[model samples]
Target: MWRSKARQWLLRIPTPKCSPLQYQVPPGTLIASRMPSNRPLPTFTCLQNPRLLSASPSFNSRDLDDSDVGIVGNAVNADDSRESEASPVNLDGEMDESGSFGEKGQVLQEFGDSSLGFDDDKVMSEAADVDSLSSLWEESVSADDSSGVFGSQEASDGVVDEIHEVDDEQVESVLSLLQSTLVEPLEASLNKMELSLSEDFAVRVIETPSISGENLVGFFKWAWRNCRSVRTARVVELLVLAVSDVPELGKREGYMLWDLVKEIGAEKGIVKTEILNQLISMFWKMGKAKAGLEVFDKFADFGCVPNSDSYYYTIEALGKRSMFDTAWTVCEKMISSGRLPDREKIGRIIAFFCKGKKGKEAHSMYSAAKEKEICPQRSWLDSLVCSLTKNDETVSLAFELLDDYAKGSLKYANKSFADVVKGLCRIGDVKEAKKLVLRMVESGPPPGNAVFNFVITALSKGGEMEDAIALMKVMEGRGLRPDVYTYTVVMSGYAKGGMMDEACKIFSEARKRHSKLSPATYHVLTRGYCKMEEFEKATDCLKEMKKDGVQPNTDEYNKMIQSLCLKALDWRTAEQLLEETKESGVPLKGITRSLIAAVKELEVEIQSAENNIEA
Candidate 1:
């Protein structure tokens, strides 16, 4: 059976043997087989069946001739006996495998142990087994090739699983090793790979989320450092992906990328618009606005004329932060570059001025826009009108300009009409304001709530309380709900006319309606109470002012104190109020001193009258 096992092992090898004389055992065979002891063999009864033995060439060595049987049997017994004496081993490379004498022998030799005896039969048997194993391996490899088995199919299927198992350990080791010795060479290799695969693979690789952004950036920097044009585009693509993934990295390394782009421009003659945009956006997002602008300037030097969207992004960033001056400068640069600013950018500029209450500049910009044939859109006109109304002088000019422009053949005339009417009423132009409103209602859509509110405010301020009320009724009749401004204006009108009951009624109505009450509304009410000589009511309003988180200005405080003094005819309280004002950090200006002097004069006249009456 043992001889048969040897023969079977040999027959499984597909390669034809050279003449028997040419067969030689490898050098380690002899040392591997020799041992001092032996053990019982595994059961060979399974191989006792003749039919089974005959069916398997690997198990049929008993059918060989006597000489062949003798040689095969001796080799088999020798290898088995030697293997039986070998010690068992563990998986950590610290021990030899059981029944494998070669590994033990090598270990023992290294430890200076040569007392073990050698066995020639064991050596020959081991040599024959090794030959058979090599022949079987070669045959299996060829068969796999002929059968069209892919080399890495199995590896590919298990790659993720394998990576999960090994990544933690291998990543650190591999990265450290790569860093220590292979960095430059690996960088060069990656650069070459980038150049070769740019056209074919860049898009796919860049869009992959699993790719390491740091690695991608490193490779890009390497490629840029080497002045490799062939890889520049691919490197750029990877850099874009890196920036998209890790925006903070771009901010930290923006200057380096900028320098790289400049180098690319000098070496490859390729202008990198995408890189410039990425750098700008990154710096802006990181709150480095100045750096963002610097990169934008570089884009121009690279002959990259930024598109409208780019300008819009930069301008909007500045405008949102109330940096109107910067935004205007950027706008000028954009226009000077022959790029027309869009409506959104223009709207932002208008909003910035409105927020800052720079009415004159806003109006100037609007006029400039019109002169450039840039038809201001509805939103731009709305903001412009609001801004103009903040200052009286500009408001009148703005209304006239809008009226004139609307009369012309300009396309935006209809929108301009609404804007002018709103501006006119905003600045208290009652007659012309009513005319514009009538024109709008007769020829166009009926007056909007904003238009009605403005007209009511103008009429109320002009003391046309009846007309203002009529307009409010008209608005309600037209199913237009009056807003807080309408109620506030009417209440102010009643208060100015000393109609305390009417003013209180309007205030109660406003509160019940839940209409908005702004600081100006409160100011109007406070002044009204003072005019009525209702000091307690006025003080109550001031307390409400505090509760509402409104900081009363020096004017409001001064008016309140003056009204209190006048009502009580108390000179001492008035003087104390002036001292309190100084303590509250309100500087005593020339007007305040004059009022104090006038109060002292009244006190002198009162004292002289009292003295004469007593005499």
Candidate 2:
């Protein structure tokens, strides 16, 4: 029976109603029950139940003033007509006697409240608490609405001022602020922000890119001045690493970053050689070789000893720019210190030095590499050998290096062996080159056509045609077919020694072995025929060159014209060759044309003088 009463009383609560004259509820609108004026109201706490106490839809704010709500827990009977006329719940008009509930007020006028059971004291207490409930709820909702969203610009704007308490949210806040800020000066942009730079924060600033490198440096500088935490060694390292990874880091930014690091390092005495090495490498990427050297020179200033990477990078920087003299000083310092880097870097160092014509100076670095038992790359080792062979005095050193190839310094190959042989030929050491070729024939990586050709060419150049011919026979016997270049070199050497018959014999052998010949091959035999004053043979060799699909270049045509006009004084043939070169669109020198005309005129003058003498 009591449960049935509870349900009846619950339905009896009033639902919100709209006014006949449309009305909008202002903020903090309130609702309350209307009671009879003739008797005291019942004690109630809004029954503290969801269904028994319903809110007016118009009173939507949780922050409404508590002054309008009061203790209404008692009920009493009144005249029916008066109650109906004064009740705020009346849909006919206003539902109150004095209408204190106002035009838009909603209430339950007669719900038979006397039988509805609620604990009197508990109900009264809950009613009193509602007075302050609105304020508390309003405060919470307002706070959340202010800062509830992610990456809110206004929420993160004041982060720099809140650095004492830090988290990922704050860090991300700072990052987005920095990226989106339009303030010209970075420090000025950060002026209003609360900044406490952690190592991780500094790293994110550097590595979380989008800000220009200049702006990043600007942010870094500002942090240095305003935040001491950013000056730590770990942060500086990450800064350097991050900067190094930026391939397009500007020179100005690099210098600025270096300055910041230098200042921090000098203050903390935490500057390291590895960090400085990283800077040098970064500068090399920036194409600042001199800057790299400058970094190298600062090692003593920082009390850090120069390590192998230090020297290698410095030399590499200078070497890439062809600054051998500057690179050599670092090389010498490395040598004197008795240290060298890994084989790849060491090989590159050798290559750099060699490219700058400092192969002899690079030898010391190579020697240090050897003493350390670090074998460089084969290409770089070959580079070192080739560099060493540039000087006649260093040729023996290169030979020793080659000899060490058998001892595991580098692998012996046909190409490297041929390089040494060519070096010997370059410095006019044919006999040694010959012996090396013979040695190659007897050993592994046995001599190929190139090896035999270098020795043969050298021998033929030194007027040792007999030795040259024997080397060619050796080439054939070894089943190494001579190429067009090989035949050309051999014939060149023979022609220079006035051995045209032997040169022609070599040419015949080249033609038999290959369908085509190099222009130099035809040039060699043509010059040989000219040197023998055999014009017919020279012309025939040139025509044979074209028939074999060898297009004569400018040098070939020029040499032929020069030989005919100057050496043989055959103007007619010179003009014919010039016209052929023009028809083929080959560019010939004007001097050769003038020479032909002069020779032709001289022949005419001699003929006219003979005619006058006969007359």
Candidate 3:
């Protein structure tokens, strides 16, 4: 009877709405439960003991008074509602409010507080403790976010700063150690430290302010001795730049670094062509052209063959320092290697030779280069021929070189031939220049009239009036009309040679042909009169210049003043001419200013003499 009564009581119990179980059940397992209404019991598969579920005694308890039970039931309902609102449970029950099983247990424990046998006061105290623990957890998380592995944000930054300070201190330590130890004898220091000088160590040496060049040299020597190698390019280039930044060491004195660098490089058996070339250029920029050449010469010893650029820089540096012989040797080497210097470098070398009046050597180098099938470029040849022609000793040879080259190489024949004529004319070899001009006409189309004008001018200047006129006739026959430059050249040439009549005739011809004389044409006539001390005639020419709407430029005025002071001995007229020049807004030439001073000095001397006589 008691069992039947218990069964009835159990049957009357409504199905409780509980939280989803955390554990999973096997497939095909059945669960049975009854509803509150008069409905049949529902069967659930894959669930065990659906009628009576096991609950943890620590979370749920059966010991409760009726009043406490009522309160606990309401509290459990409220807690369930709060959990449901906090995290929605999936209907399929595949996941719970807490996806993790451990978190789900904590959730269950918190909700299980309602089933505890404690009174309302004990439950309230536990709730307050739980809230305090949650707040502490959040604050700990916040602290972790700000501090990372360190204690606080500032402490984290302080850690990073400490790391940087450690690195800086390491650098300072290394530098200080090197400064003290490197001052000792190199062998003794090496023996004591047994140092391994790496690129960083070399960089430290280069950047250290207390490091002297001698100390640097010793360090590198020691490094090379121990390691059998050195940082030839990287360390050396940095050292060079550093030394160059120092004004005292930047000049030729800085080249001492090269000696050390070379020693190190040679010891290491490292001879790179590009590095050597750069070293040469570095020396040149530092005003050590000779040192650059020295580096160039040693390139072969290091097994690096000098390229055309290498040879060009060496020759240029040598030439710039007026070391012509060495420059010529380097050029010869360049040519022997079947290479030619670049045009700009060639011009520099040629100018160097011209300044020294060693034009024959320059021409010889050109000829040798051509013989070796390494002809200079046309622009370089033009500069060379121009330089050679300016020298009296090499003008004929320069023309011969052009004439010979013209026979085989017609590409530059016309231009080369023209250079020859112009060069010969510049050297007052109009006779040769005319012959070369005819040769050029035969070889190619007629040369420009400017070529004939150069020869005519040269002949007239040489007092060969007949040759000058003949060349002019030849120019006209070739359908080349003489321009203002031509007339000016011929007239100035005749005037310089004191043949005023021929100059006048050339002027008349210019007017007849062109129908107008340029300002330069008038200046030529004025200069001619000045050279002959014909002051009145020169003055008339100036007046005609103004009447013809051409002003006498500074050169024309300077020429007249110089003649009046030097030849005419008429300081008064020179003074008046200078005053007019100033009024005309022309800047006085240096020579003109000196002439005024001379006139003032002469006047002071005359005044002193008259005073002495009066006394």
Candidate 4:
């Protein structure tokens, strides 16, 4: 009856299925039968059939854990050797039909005695080992279940990296939504886009067409309230661009804006160099260049270091608007700070210095640049050389710099030689220029056609047409062909000398060589005819300009209308020209002013003649 009960338990249990790594046991089933080391194995003295001790069908390597097998291997039976061997169960909890009970008892006894040693110390050590292994297996299974629910660690990280990358199109779309002028709509658009902007980029995007000053200030306050980090430079720049056009951004407004920016900068501990430079750029763009200079002066009080770009832009802005004295002060400041302006900026500085008639100071700057191994641009060097040659005292020094430059860098020899010729001719010293030309020709490398054109232009302006015409012939004798600039210069010279026929001949020659002539070339001929009071020829010039697809600018139209007005032509013709000027989208202010003044003067003369006749 005991054998039947054990056999029935084994049959009732389900079979274990094989998996990739191990066999799986049924849920809620105890995979191993535990018998404590302190307790003895159960004795079945009445059970005679050894097959009843066979393992359940559900029992497999995975169903019985390693610890259960270890305990079974340590179990010893005290039955007779033949009877123990006849038992079917093996130490691995598997049924072994070939082993008799006697052999099983012998194997079990040997396993328990030799391997387990069955002492208290040995059992305790084995128990600790089993506990550690069990904990490790549980942890591994928990990790696998988590991974199955989600994904592998590497795959999840890749998805997160992709989500963080910024898209330019998305940024533009967000900016587009903020085009509404109303605060409520703007807030709604921002929420709809679900976007956040860095405060600097946000300020840049405030240039939407419908955004007003009030809207901007509200948005700024909102950003501040929300603790957004805005760049001081970008905020100042945006305010200057957007608000300066509305009304005078008065001292009170400027102070408020600056205080806000400064307070933020102080809180963040940011470097204020860039912010100050931006303020200067803003003032210059708004035509408040003197104010920009004052802003630069405040840099020291704010503990900001003004960089080379700061001084460079200030000087350039002042110089462009003819504020030379202030520009010089800023340049001096830059030099004192021991920071050299970059190559492009240095060109502007040298040009400004030359404009102030301080050729010596400009040359000194160029020398310093050279000493520092900063190569000046070809255009800047040419301008400096020309300016130096214009003055009697610096001409020799200019040549010395050029000679030194030529020795060090051989690439600019032709350009240097041409500029020198042009400068000497400009100053009405063609005799020295002629000598230089002869030397350039006799030498292995000849001067360009630009030098010959410069000489011809000088002679024609000085009333030496015969000499000018002779030089043009000699220029063609050389292998070099004249470019459009060469032709334009000669035409300008002839026109200025009242030699319209000669000027037209040069214009036709240029047209023959190159099918297209510049608008400047056409203007030269028109002005020459106008000066000669040949209205028909001048009118023909305008028609030709139109046929050539060259739209005359405001100045060109002014010249033509002035000629017509001075000739006392019909007001109807002037009216027609005014209409054309309007249709062409050129500004009508100057043209209309000239026409109105000319008509009023003609009316006054007509009334005076009528009064004389009546008397």
- Estimate TM-scores for all models: 0.43, 0.56, 0.43, 0.37
Residue-by-residue lDDT tens digits, candidate 2, 1-615:
322332333333332332312322222222343445443322122232232122222333233233333222222223323324432432223335764344443343343533334544444444433324334334443445423411233434433234444467767776776678565666776776776666667777777867665667677777778777777767667667876776577888889878877776667467777889999998877878998998899898888899988888888787668788877888889889976787778777777778777777777777788788885556766787877777778887887777656545333556667778988898988888889988877765677777787787778678887887788788878887777777787788888878888888888988898887778788888888888889889999889988988999998888889888888889999999999998999998989888999999999999999999999
lDDT at 34, model 4: 38
Candidate with the larger lDDT of 1 and 3: 3
Q: Model 3 off-target regions past 4 Å? A: 1-219, 225-256, 259-281, 293-313, 329-357, 403-419, 426-429, 442-446, 457-473, 477-479, 483-615
| lDDT by residue (tens digit), candidate 3, 1-615 | 322222222222232355534223221111111112222212222222331222211222223223221111112233234334443222222345454222221112222232333455554444432234334434454565424321354542343222211244444554565567445565575566545456566676667776555555555556656653345567666665555444445443356667766675654445467667767776666557778888887876777788877987787667667787777787778767876665556656666766666777777666655675654665555556666767677677766656444344565556656767787766666677788778767776368876777787777667777777777777788888878887787787778878889888888888788756788898888887887778989888888878867777887888888888888767888888888888889877887879867977887899999999999
| Span of ten consecutive residues with least summed lDDT in model 3 | 26-35
lDDT (Cα, tens digit) per residue for candidate 1, span 1-615 = 433444445322222322222333222211121222343321111111122122222322223332342111112222233333434322122343343333223221110112222344454354543445435535554545522322233432333222212233333333343335454556655544333322223333344444444544554555345543435555574566465556346444555555666666664436566666776666656666676667667766777768765665676556556677776777666556555556666677667767777767666666666767887766666566656755767767666555443433444445555567766776667889887777666655457888888788889888999999988887888788878788889999999999978887887787777634666667778889888777778778876865767656778777766776567565565577577667767665566566767777988998999999999
lDDT of each: 0.57, 0.69, 0.61, 0.62
The lDDT-based order of candidates, best leading, equals 2, 4, 3, 1
RMSD of 4: 21.2
Instruction: Give the best candidate by lDDT.
Output: 2
Model 4 / residue 272 / CA error / Å: 2.1
The 10-residue segment with the lowest total lDDT in model 2? 43-52
Q: Which residue segments of model 1 deviate by more than 4 Å?
A: 1-214, 225-227, 231-238, 245-250, 341-388, 391-426, 448-457, 460-615
